[model samples]
Target: MATPAAYDGLISHAGSLFWIQSGEGPDQLVTWTASDGVSLAAPQGFELGNEIHAYGGGAVTASASGVWGVSSKDGRIYRLTSDKAEPLTGHTGDQLGDLVVRGETVLALREGTNGDQLVDVDTSTGHVRVLLQSSSFLSSPRPGPGYVAWLSWDADHMPWDSTQLWVARYDDRSGGSLGTALLVAGGHSESVLEPQWGPDGSLYFMSDRTGWLNLYRWDGERTYAVAPMAADCAAAPWELGYRSYTPLENRKIAMRARRDLEDHLLLVDESGHSETFQLPFTAIKPYLCTIDNAVAMIAATPTTAPAVVLVERDGSYAVIAGQEPSQDEVRQPERHSADGIDFLLHPPIDAETTWRAPVIVRAHPGPTDEISLRRDPQLDFFTRHGFAVADVDYRGSTGHGRAFRSSLYGNWGSYDVEDCAAVARHLITLGITLAGEVFICGSSAGGYTALRAATTTGPFRAASARSPIIDPKRWEASVPRFQRAHATALATGATAVSSAAIECPVLLVHGLHDPITSAQDTAALASDLKTRGADHELLMLDTSSHTLAAPDLAAQVLDAELRFFRRMLDQSESAKRT
Candidate 1:
């Protein structure tokens, strides 16, 4: 019952025994200790500079500390306690993203893959302290010594338009700067994102006006309402890399759903109390694992990928099943080529502490690069709501090799956006990630590499870009002729650019019955991000087309993207003292 690639990743030491972020090299993070199930010692050469597929957080702590991660050229923060690995550089802005950890200090929350430095590193002292920036897009870093709550959007085009809800509190031993950001709850026709912070401070997030997708709380002083809109929701508050574990107790906030029905393990305390643990296993894919005292996850099917059975704590479930999931010796088989590139790396199972998981970069669609991870129960509803997903086949996108899928013929968006931003900055130098809270999704040519990763090279925080072909001269002057001969080499190297140099906040879902990315090219790409202003939001749905992965339109696009990233990511600890 363990031969689906051996079903890697359930608990090889507890963290990432066999976690993956999609194929290729230099992005190590492979563990397997407890005395070898197949051997995976790890650590050597360790190089991820200039970054390629980078995304590793900053902590294995109980051992490795002060971590923050991300790459494809920058956004690092390291301070590994034992085994010496100090690499904190303040903040220079290249790649590093939505990350957290305040106790021993390591909160890299960034977004400037090009402009807007949201810095916060100190991992002992590489000292990069900025705290805020323009055209923002942050989330992760909820509670703090004095204060810290994030979820912002000063308006990029319409990115959930007119958004706000940012909390701050300087002097956490002197890291000052965040005097203004009051406005707890804006108009929110499109914003009020994911502000977590549970344990007791009570922040819990995810909102969508009243339309659906619910789960809210604020109590740093006000904002109440607790759980209702379920286009498919379950007490929002993710961290475990996508949405795997958010157990907070007393005030409660458990989760592990399949939305409407079927896959269950839902909780939601604080007053909302929404119960359901039922599990005999039908969960096509669910993974909200790890919360200590009790809360583990892993449910699979699509030929199979299970390890699940551990529901414990009065409830009962300690079923081991074959015994797989181990690969976090912090992998290093060592291999990387450049002539047309050849890479290799499939190790990342930090054995728990908090090693991070979810990567799923996978984007081909450019001339059918087909790479596969097929199944689709919304990928098991994003691994039963806890994500450790990964998949990427870049080089112009396809299954692999054909001159690497014709090298995007004339460089269609430069080697599949530099091999999907070099395999997410090579798994952020192999720590597995503490920064780049990437969700660089795709659809039409991987939604043009998740909309060219919000204007070429990002420190990504969420990009659910479905049906995006992104201006290849407006898709070869409006497609047609046998699909414009398979998009004449990506509209002769795509030209009509201008999603206003894209400054992050996009949620653009499409399909008013999309035939081939046309609902007037997503309403003229949301009217060219409102004539080049940029911070967009589109959502068309209805009869919906262009397989958004399906399963009831990927459960109404993961419930308006966890309520448009929980109102862009709330940070009000009750306005932190406004």
Candidate 2:
């Protein structure tokens, strides 16, 4: 019963509904009662989490003059009302986030050091007002009824590799300002996203011009696509109100796409007709919220785990909050077709196993991210311990489009270390496991693709990596000068594989306040694998970060990575009986 902390801002107002449960501590803000669920902020030293573009979503939003969020200890912009939450932007170093509110003003998305604009605060004198600056990165500002749409993108694109969708004109006669924005769709090589205004004001978005990521509608001068399909109704904005579609009730829409990696739920209608709806989820979160024809969403189901649901147009859905993962602790993955590689295998929850189980694989940390058949209790704790997970959606991932997500752009650590050694040689050519029992884990660009798959592979008999990036040229000197040109276009020309070309046993784990991969780059690659003697073993957690969000330091870093993969599979079965 202790597994509920995976729900995000699922808004809806006037009918009363809100979400955000940042798991366990700080970043709560619940609210929904017909049987229970309240919280509304503060239950452990304030935090609503929103670091803006450092992977912070449209942290909390709801209107009628209440609930606005973004605090995670001073990135500013609060306003909870009735239950008291305060601080409406004093600009404590200006970070703010993708909020919206309007009608007392909120608009947000600031980020500082002179980049990312579209301001507006002032819910009563917290005064801010920039309204729109040239973008290098800005995001969904979305105001309506006089115009104020948003989303920019440059610095060589990565809001799914391209974005634009402007549209200004929001005046409020002098005290608001925002007029010359224009550029409707997106720049060439499409990738627009979530603009939204509808109910006759017409604008709605999510593009990817024919290469997937569908749904469109403009009406200020004609655009209309509404539902195209190849799959991928949005994702890869990496933050900011990531909704795949919304705008129901008589104009009907409620989307959510993605293909081979699951997630369905369509419902178009308004004369365009679209239907797909066989519920039991497969990962559906991109903020839907609507309440009148009922929509709301937070879904999940590879054996269920995330829940906030609501849906109703006769598809009948309810959950309203989380919890649902017991079918003997659910495992369900099976989808390994190979070819250009797209994974998800999970076998071994206890299939009368006598041996042959040690598998792992994993690798997902946005080397441009992707891997969502949802409910991952750390890949079900490696198939309930007997181990057999695979989960890689490699080749730059992201619901597979944009030429398989630009094939890992400058080849991030060589196409995610050859898609984790082609899913460990298609899971040992389908016999499922063998070849030194396979292993390879990842964290943070999949810990630099599990230390670049232990230096160009031996089909991994040992490798764990969290917080890795041992040295993509010294990790592009800690990127963030507006993402050092996307970390120099994903580590320009790749090739850095070292740790002395690892031959086996390596564990590494890091998190001494990982502000984006740096526990001294896993203590200088465990001090150069202890000056070349190699056979690694680092650890170091001192109160984890880089999303290890503490659940007893993520079960002591998964019990020190299942005791370093069972002492490297018992020293490879004691070197095969000597």
Q: What is the TM-score of each candidate against the true structure?
A: 0.28, 0.35
lDDT of 2 by residue, 131-229 (tens): 767647878888888888897888765777678898988853468577777898888588898888987899888888878788888888888887777
- lDDT (C-alpha) at residue 6 in model 1: 22
Cα lDDT of model 1 by residue, 44-85, tens digit = 323322211122232222214532333333335454322444
Q: What's model 1's overall lDDT?
A: 0.49
Which parts of model 1 have CA positions greater than 4 angstroms off?
Answer: 1-150, 157-193, 202-244, 248-293, 296-412, 417-442, 447-512, 519-543, 548-578
RMSD of 1: 24.2
Q: Name the best candidate (by lDDT).
A: 2
- Evaluate residue 433 in candidate 2 and report its C-alpha lDDT on the 0 to 100 scale: 86
Q: Which ten residues in a row have the lowest lDDT in candidate 1?
A: 50-59
